[model samples]
Target: MVWPPSLRQLEFGDGFTVRIATLKGPPSLQQLWIGHWCDEHIARVGWPMSLQQVFFSGNFDQPIAGVAWPTSLRVLSFGEKFNQPIAEVMWPASLQQLSFGGSFNWPITGVVWPVSLEELSFGDGFNQPIAGVVWPASLRQLSFGNRFNSPIARVMWPVYLQELSFGDAFNQSIAEVVWPASLRQLSLGRWYDQPISGSIFGVVWPASLRQLSFWCRFDQAVAEVVWPASLRHLSFGVCFNQPITTVAWPASLQQLSFGDRFHQPIAE
Candidate 1:
């Protein structure tokens, strides 16, 4: 097919195979989504230098150690069926945002993430332990999959991380985890019912924290929790019926929500 020189984006339907040596796409193509189930050798489809975003949303599960990823690629993603190991694949230097699909449960401890990465998110099936994984210094936002309940006490969080979110099954003790000083937003999982008493963790949260959210089943008391002075938003989960009369609400708080179960009297 003769692709138009002015064509900028292209997404192939499923069941396509790369029998040609090169895709011969237009020079103006900046984004490409390949959805072929049988194409194992992705490097055979020569990527244009102008391509900035690439997505693999098919059954391409072959090891990609020898694939020559494009230099200008800034965003890359895979679909829910992609479960290949990427520990040996050299990632693009300029890649910023990367997301794994639902079925990617491969071990990623040895994978060297891009140095310029800003946002990285794992899919629901990724529950790999990451104690040895060194996240990039430039990462600002990071999130785990729904089944990820790995211990993060020994993991070194990035210094500039701004937003961090855990999945629904993560109910591990966070008393020993030292959150990043630059963290501005934090969200705990739905099943996180652990005690975050100030006596146990002690002024642990960074002063830069602006938003905090507890999950649906979190019914812990906040009277002993140390609310950050810079906190602007706080949310307690649905099952919380804890008394707030003695709780010290932060002076900087602008938005406060005691989930559906907060019907206790203010003077209680």
Candidate 2:
């Protein structure tokens, strides 16, 4: 079916399959969202020149050829079941953000990422170690899902990164890891129930840090940890039972949120 030339966005829900190669439309289209489809179906499609974002929530089990990608695409998100290795796929130079959903277990250590990429995210089942991965220098934000338990301590983080997050299975101590000086926000991995005794204190947090969040299973007392003077926001997860007042609050703190187990009274 021929869509209106003025259409800018197209979205197809589950169980719906549309042959984009057969569809007729103008180059005004910017976003394309589709359900399960094979690489041949995507390769055959004539993508609009103006398309910037492509989101696929289908079963992409086959490898995607470089010709299947649109040069104008800036953001690309794969489905939960897409397990194809992206090493063979030629990422567009314009890409800024890339995400891998569930079931994507390919190792990205040797894969070349687009230099323009600023944000990178991983979903469940991505357990491959990224220690030797050559990360894009332009990266600013990074996140991982529950099953990602890679040892990031050996990875050389981009100096420009501002936000860093980890998955539930990542219980490795980050106290000795050299964090970037540009980091502003940090989110610890969930399911981390270990005591934070003096581990956090051993690391030198960047002065640029503004936000810090604890994982859901963190129930340790952080009173011994020295909070950064540049911190503005702090949050605790569900199982954290430590009293909020026991820790020395930073003078720059403007927002504080505690978990359900914290019943301490605010002295303000």
Candidate 3:
């Protein structure tokens, strides 16, 4: 089918294999989401110069070499099955956000990140130690997936980081982790089953933190967990059956959300 030249977004869903080589013209496509059958022919097509976001979830087991990607691309995402190490891929310099899926288990310790990157996300299979990785200085947000069990306490977090997230399997205590002072939002893994104990209280939270969120399976006594005075928003996910009566809520807390399992009543 012939697409119009003014097309801005294109999504190739399941059961459809797009052969870009057969396409007639370069539509002004800004976003491209491809299915599993998309092959190397994508690089051979005359992509629109206005293209900015590309999401490829194909069966790319081998390295994606010599693909002439659009220089205007800003966001790139790979599906769970794309396991090729990205160390050899010539990433576009204009990229600001990058994400990997569960199939990506490659180590990127020595890989150089784009200087323009602002956000980075890892999939469930990514267990590499990011402590020694040279993160781009411009990075402000980072996230980890369920299978990522790396010890973040030893990693040197970026000074400019404002948001951080952990996966369910990240069971390490943050007692020794030096959080960045610029952090404002923190999200704990939904699958983290450990109780919130002294390991959490031992760490000194950054004064800039304003939002703190806990995920499912985080059942612990709130009395033992020290609430940071700088916090303004607090949230708990389902399966968190902890009581709040014995806990000391910080005066700065402006909002509070409880899960269905928490049956304790709040005092006025």
Candidate 4:
């Protein structure tokens, strides 16, 4: 398919070539989906006519160097062998969702989340550090994997965060995580390391939290399973033989699960 220099919409799949010169005159396109075999070249997407979604997949023979564009992008999803500089990637102010799960790297600088972003998900193989990112104010969900190699310190969660998940290999301390008031579901799973220190759990949790699960090493027993009064689902975990006494469960609890120590089913 021949691409007009001032093209406003372009979608190519298989046996197609997208040369940098194909996109000339700085045409502002609203949608672009490239799933073809193209020559390796760096090109700017120039101005987008309110770009809403973009998808780049499959193996582009040569390293597609410096392919950055889409200043008005709202949703960006990348897949397959994408060895490009992520730092050069720019997101539009109207961006609301971002899902990236491939292999790419750029200089260790920082990421600027869009003002309107609501959801962010990182698939397996992402090892970038989101430590100093200024989170989006309207974000509701942030999901990531253990590939984030840097230690997370302080985070300014959106006042509306409701669901958060960190993959098993993640080793950062949750001591500094300040849950937002609107948070309802929080999960900290499969992490390498024994019993998280008491001081770690000392951080105040969202009073509105309904579901809580700790699947990592709890080398010691928690004297109290402080399940939020609004909590309906609770999961308590202890090391294989770590002893624990009768937990003070909330009457509001509808379902509960305990590990090996409490071999019996949780009472209603």
Q: All candidates' lDDT scores?
A: 0.85, 0.80, 0.78, 0.62
Candidate 4 residue spans exceeding 4 A from truth: 1-32, 36-42, 45-50, 60-72, 105-109, 192-203, 216-220, 236-245, 258-268
Candidate 3 versus the native: TM-score?
0.82
Candidate 1 segments exceeding 4 Å error? 15-22, 36-39, 201-203
Tens digits of per-residue lDDT, candidate 2, 170-241, equal 777666677888999999888766555584435567788999988688887676777789999999888877
lDDT by residue for model 4 over 58-131, one digit each (tens)?
65433333545455667776665555554444566778887765454443245666788899877656666665
Give the alpha carbon lDDT tens digit for every residue of 184-268 in model 3. Answer: 9998886665545575445577888999988887776676667789999999888777666778888899999888888776663
* Top-lDDT candidate index: 1
TM-score of the candidate numbered 4? 0.72
Q: How far out, in Å, is residue 3 in model 1?
A: 1.7
Q: For model 1, how does the per-residue alpha-carbon lDDT over 35-144 read when each residue is reduced to its tens digit?
A: 75755666566778888998887576666677787798899988777888889889988999999888899888898999999999998998988878889999999998
The TM-score of predicted model 2 comes to 0.87
Model 3 spans > 4 angstroms off:
1-4, 18-27, 41-47, 193-201, 221-225, 237-246, 260-268
Candidates 2 and 4 compared by lDDT, better number: 2
**Which is the winner by lDDT between candidate 3 and candidate 4?**
3
User: Which candidate achieves the best TM-score against the true structure?
Assistant: 1
